[model samples]
Target chain A: MMVYVIKVGGNVIDNPVLLEQFLADFAKVQGKKILIHGGGKIATRIGDKLGITANYVDGRRITDAATIDVVTMVYGGLVNKQIVAKLQAVGCNAIGLTGADANSIPASKRPVKEIDYGFVGDVVAEELNISSVKLLLDAGLTPVFSPLTHDGKGQILNTNADTIASSLAIALSGSYAVRLIYCFEKKGVLRNAADDDSVINLINRDIYQTLLAEGVLTDGILPKLQNAFNAIESGVKEVLIGHADDVRKNTTDAVAGTLIC
Target chain B: MMVYVIKVGGNVIDNPVLLEQFLADFAKVQGKKILIHGGGKIATRIGDKLGITANYVDGRRITDAATIDVVTMVYGGLVNKQIVAKLQAVGCNAIGLTGADANSIPASKRPVKEIDYGFVGDVVAEELNISSVKLLLDAGLTPVFSPLTHDGKGQILNTNADTIASSLAIALSGSYAVRLIYCFEKKGVLRNAADDDSVINLINRDIYQTLLAEGVLTDGILPKLQNAFNAIESGVKEVLIGHADDVRKNTTDAVAGTLIC
Candidate 1:
């Protein structure tokens, strides 16, 4: 059976109504669709309420010991559980986990220097347990994951969710049809951020790099393009970048967003 | 020479004035002190403004391909650079990184699962480039790291700051004096969340397991205690769980929080 991978951004989650709409629509998909979500906003909100001030140097939130505690408590503990409940409420059999459960994602904490940021981890994809995910899928349970993971030493560290999806896309690409659906504010990938008419269609590995180099594509657009190329090269059949409204459109159509192969 | 690792919490970072005060205080530290910070709240806020959402499962942020892009732009691109600027403004020569520049944190994406969560990743601490940290410290530059890291696959993944701190502590433990200072809202690790006087001092490995079994701890505290133990086992000398108020206190005092050794 063809399997689709969908990444739900944290912005969608923040707006419960928008998330609900997406969930409702997601449930109607004819085939199996894997869902990944973001919750940094929610976690940070709770952190703020608890008088915790989240810190970022570049763009990464430094997960110190205390922040990891809050993230595990909020993101893993509360947000993940709640997302599962919501999916379940809509009749989606969703299971919740940290990257450590069933070795879904094996990891180790990054070595700290110049600063002691605790509990921030990096993924060890080689050690990932694909069987665990298969088991959940076999059981018809939708796995709702939090970015929280663990180092081999048994410490749970806060990690990124996007990398999780990319890894999954590569892991399942050989066996199943993987579709990376990114729900963003823009209708799709536009040639120019301001001019929607210039949405590019079908980008290969070489062209993607050129755009990135010329600075024609910069900022947030960079990693997405890289991830799309990574997924495509790894065997994921197609990559779809679009807004929430275009999800149901024929993925191959230019209306949906940028298509990368 | 003795080196101590000090982790600054997000709470202090949220309040610019308080953070400035901290920077001033840190400037006065006599010996070599490595600082790590958490910046999730602000990152999330900025992501929201940019129409991005931050998601997590367990404790990991769901970094789908697109989300990873947004995160890198936000965390590594803007936030990390901004922090370096902030520290520099305070006369602290700081260098920012996304863990990829120096291969400081080697990582891999979790295996693709039934569902795709995009670019989420975890750490490979053993493969970390600690020499990069040493180089910066040798030149008197305080390295400020954003939580975004690469999986050694030319992909960047958002990570929790805390795990970064812990891993760094463990890796550097053999060479430098490591002290993990986690400041939070609570004054210290309490025997009972309601009782401030229930502060416990000096928890070893075995007793921590006892506390978990006895249900004396729950939620995020469980993971933190586990991380504390892991750090100690991994060779980190001293771990302190306390409040930001005590940041300036005598580093050796068992003054207000739980001490893990």
Candidate 2:
């Protein structure tokens, strides 16, 4: 049996129509699956409304104390619960969770080097609780995780959703043939930045290195591709990055988006 | 063989020392247990900080859209996760949840009678998902619930923690001998509002109604006592209302707090 670890970003989550469409398609997936979500834009927007300005270093938000509170509310409370309820409405037995819930994932605070990223967490793959997650999956419950982890010292830390998805996929790969999916707004990793239809259908580690050396892949796509390749090397059976609406189509045809092997 | 349903209010949750002490004691409780928590004051404080003025009618905060967002962040995100983490540190495996998780509790939006309570939810006992909860409990996992429920229609509704504790106790009574405990700052139900030591040791239904008629049991204690008697009549084995610090003492002595029969 195949298990999928799907990660969706704010572009799909913030839009009600896109979210509903993605969840409906997600519910149709066969076998065991998990959904990990990101809500950075929503968190920042809510922070702005609350008069808390967001600070970013190298395109990653520096999570301050107040910003941590805001993200917990937006990502863990609002976005997470709303997605679970929507899935429930579509006959999916979704169980929403943060890392602190059942101590499913314990992360260490990121050590400061160049910038002080307050309250940000880095999860080690070994510390992930596979048994508890397997228990939920065995009971036919789909776990929906928010991008939050605990330090096991009563502190909730903001985490990266893609990192979480990849980590879960790598850790669970020992028991299940895991497939990691990254769903967003674009068709996939575009060969040309301007063309929505210019998706690279397949990429190996050599192609990824060549794309990086040629400066064809830069900015946000770099980290995503890095994560995909890392998951593949770490034993994930496959990795796919594509538009949220094309999940079913991509999986069915086995030819959509960028497939990393 | 026995299940304990403990409810703690904001008075304890808002205080760091008191909360740690209480969770330490709660972690020591033998056998299966669950916790329900309230966050009215914390929610109102966050709402005020966000420039959203809270509206109230007959002492219940009208859960308008903004208030609902605030409470969801404070209660479900901040407070719930914090408690679960604390419990984990004490070697107790706690899984935090809102009613929407696993569709554990489905409620209906409260209909406007004389007051429009905005997004408040009223849960019917029949709609409670006892099996999912039992799955967690039987696995030796403690469920820490925040006072939030969904309407099964994609709307998250603000609920009262006391009501949730009572409903859960009533629903689970058939499977285990359930003991419902309400923990707060005070020693117990006091004869006079000012005296902390003047706790009524026991109160039957007749005495409860007589005390209410005589205007002795008024204000916050009234609703709590009502919930206590409701639980008892609904088949819960025991109900206790008292100080959070005295939970272990109360259970051991079987003589602490006001016992409702």
Provide per-model DockQ scores. Answer: 0.02, 0.71
Q: Write the residue-wise lDDT of candidate 2 on B27-81 in tens digits.
A: 9998899999988477777788778999989878899988887887788887888
TM-score per prediction, in order, is 0.49, 0.96
How do the residues B100-138 of candidate 1 rate in per-residue lDDT, one tens digit apiece?
644567667767776555675567888776765665565
Segments in model 2 whose C-alpha atoms lie over 4 Å from true places: A253-255, B253-255
DockQ, prediction 1: 0.02
Candidate 1 residue spans exceeding 4 A from truth: A113-117, A250-255, B1-261
Alpha carbon deviation, residue B233, candidate 2 (Å): 2.1
Reported per model, the fraction of native interface contacts reproduced equals 0.00, 0.72
- Whole-model lDDT, model 2: 0.88
CA error at residue B224 for candidate 1, angstroms: 31
